[model samples]
Target: MVRWLLVLLMFTGMADAAPPSLYSLLSQGQYQPPMQVMLQLEQNYPGVITQFDIDVQNGELIYEFNMLDPDAKTTVGFAFKASNGSLLEQKVAKLESDDLEELAAVTLMRQKQLKFSQLITLATGELDAYLTEAQLDHDLGISYLELKLLSAAGRHKLAFDIANLRPLPLLKWD
Candidate 1:
């Protein structure tokens, strides 16, 4: 199957590798965790913080936060300077109905006290994998966390329920 072939290519190192995690930068003690800033923004703007990542631009670490603002019905991206957690840039786009549904699921997930970073930590610890990225995803009315990971075996895309951290039926490279 084509999916099998893609998984094979990923495991064989033929696929593009993911960027390093923002956690590594935190461990280095040179940069503050951008989640705090994200929380602050969420409080001010009242939105769903959906994804977080660190991007290197011109040799500088840029912490990016993606969220959905319900009142405004917009998807927003906030880029912050890694060192001081200062806002660098913000981009906003209109959210479609599908996005609103995902946001609703994520909001319910928050009621259950699910944190994306905590899930990544628990999963990586259990699987002995390195976390590359975690994003909120919805498919066929199922809301899950899509985790991109790297390990000695290979790159893997694992999915887990947003509320309970239960593993979902997803592709496994190993």
Candidate 2:
């Protein structure tokens, strides 16, 4: 039993370096068949790179890359019996682009739940008569406010809580 476990610890777990962070991949991608780029990321990252939503920023198209690193033991996790250490369950989130809000807004616009009309209403009080609008409603109820943020022109930006961040898995309970 110990021998089999030993093999797995050394050979598997760490796998590869996760196909270069989505930020690096997308940044290097040319203005070509964008869909193909996304497909490649999805295929390469699988459970990690879950969503690729695009938006326009200052007239240039941008993408918000969403990833979910799965929960798994790494190659170096410590074997309690052996008191040995291994790299287990390595997870660290990353942001690939500076214009995350612009990308997120565009993503939010395509989302079914984020209606432009409601966004307009919400903006009436906080903002002046609208020159443009966007909405992002699919966020977990806790981050629901992020939807409103994406819609406002000149103010669209994504600011997430890094410390409390949780994986937004592609899987759903409902």
Candidate 3:
């Protein structure tokens, strides 16, 4: 695991020589850019680092990373400059998810003819939204809404009845 640790250290820690010309970090779900990574990126690249934005596009192994205008909320897909923080190679992609899937807990109440394939797609969408919206930013186990969304697709029924289970307020995923 020493090699892994070294790579992780490289995320935020200083390089023995210079900023990595090209680099990558581990991510299974949400790509929370570690503070150390940002610091090192800034130190090595200076003004080019700019701001980091985290997002998940389903059906993908890696999350699509982006830089944003801190004030304007403008998004760019590629490199920023050390000279002036100008975003470069900014090719705009069409979309992440075009399907209308929702994770709202109320989805369980709907009994519809959504296909098995369609169900998984919808459930995945809802799961993504729920996880991103939770106060803690993640839930280890499936909750009422997640199960319900799945049920709409015939994957699984709402296992536990959540009568009084009000979901906590959504938290900002920093």
Candidate 4:
């Protein structure tokens, strides 16, 4: 019984410790705001930001953005230094018809009253999950929030509708 009690205490302590928020990280000078990086990219190629996520690549934090250029009908991917927002990599790809369809859907969904921070809080509370990565994407005329979570079960991915915050099942593994 004593051993079980100790184990429970340890688990409880772990559960009480939530991961730091993105804003806090920014305040600490760890990573630049993804929106800021996206805006810098837009100066050269005006487009709609379809995806934004922070990732560790090559042993450093990389802020990545995927933008849909309506005028060119192409998708541009940019990677920047998380700490300073310096451009590190850029790739431009031809957008497919399906991609455009999804973009339209995402644009419409974002017109609603949902905020990104609120969605992040809801996801963390629901799964007892730590946010590892986040992405905004559209599929089949639906805008979705993709979150990579770190939990006791290890890393898992989840999706939710941006407009309604409804959980979505994993359709495919990437």
Highest TM-score model number: 1
Rank by TM-score, highest first. Answer: 1, 4, 2, 3
- TM-scores, all models, native as reference: 0.64, 0.24, 0.19, 0.54
Worst lDDT 10-window in candidate 4: 20-29
After superposition, which runs of candidate 3 have C-alpha atoms over 4 Å from their true positions?
1-33, 58-174
Clashes of each: 0, 7, 5, 0
Q: For model 2, what is the C-alpha lDDT against the true structure?
A: 0.33
lDDT value, residue 26 of candidate 4: 39
The sequence of per-residue lDDT tens digits that candidate 4 reaches over residues 36-70 is 55556656666666666777654466777777766
Task: Please say which candidate is ahead in TM-score: 1 or 2.
Answer: 1
> Of the pair 2 and 3, which is ahead by lDDT?
2
lDDT of 3 by residue, 1-174 (tens): 999888987986664564321121122323333333334443443112222332322322122223322223233354433223333345433323321122212223223322222322333444422111110011333223322221212222222222223432341112
lDDT of 2 by residue, 1-174 (tens): 988887786698654344443333334444443334334444554233333344443334443444432232111111011011111233444443442443344344335343323333343336322121122223333332222122322334332221223222332111
Determine the C-alpha RMSD for candidate 2 after optimal superposition of all C-alphas. Answer: 20.3
User: Would you give me the overall lDDT of model 3?
Assistant: 0.29
Q: lDDT of all the models against the reference?
A: 0.69, 0.33, 0.29, 0.65
Indicate the worst ten consecutive residues by lDDT in candidate 2. 74-83
Q: Which number leads on lDDT?
A: 1
